[model samples]
Target: MKRIPMEIKVLIAIFLAGVISVLWYVYDTKAKRRAEAAAPTPISQPIDP
Candidate 1:
């Protein structure tokens, strides 16, 4: 078995974090679009004094 150094481990961790963050952003944008599409607009009614 080969041993990995601390620097390589740290780089791998950082790379994984970046990939996860990008995926999350893509997912969040899709969710927001779907929610907005499904959401209804509000209407204002007139009130008499």
Candidate 2:
């Protein structure tokens, strides 16, 4: 088996990290939107004398 160089390994790691972060961001944004949508809106009350 051939040995991989350190530079190539570092590049691969960086690329994988970038991809994972992007996926996480997309997932988080969608979850927040879903939560917001499922939440109830507050109604304004009129002041009575």
Per-candidate count of clashing residue pairs (backbone under 3 Å): 0, 0
Instruction: Go through the candidates in order and give each one's C-alpha lDDT.
Output: 0.83, 0.84
Q: Once superposed on the true structure, which residue ranges of model 2 sit more than 4 Å away at CA?
A: 41-49
Query: Where does candidate 1 clash, by residue pair?
Result: none
Provide the TM-score for each candidate, comma-separated. Answer: 0.78, 0.78
lDDT by residue (1-49, candidate 2, tens digit) is: 9999999999999999999999999999888778767867522344469
Residue pairs clashing in model 2 are none
Which 10 residues in a row give candidate 1 its minimum summed lDDT? 39-48
lDDT of 1 by residue, 1-49 (tens): 8999999999999999999999999999888778767867422334458
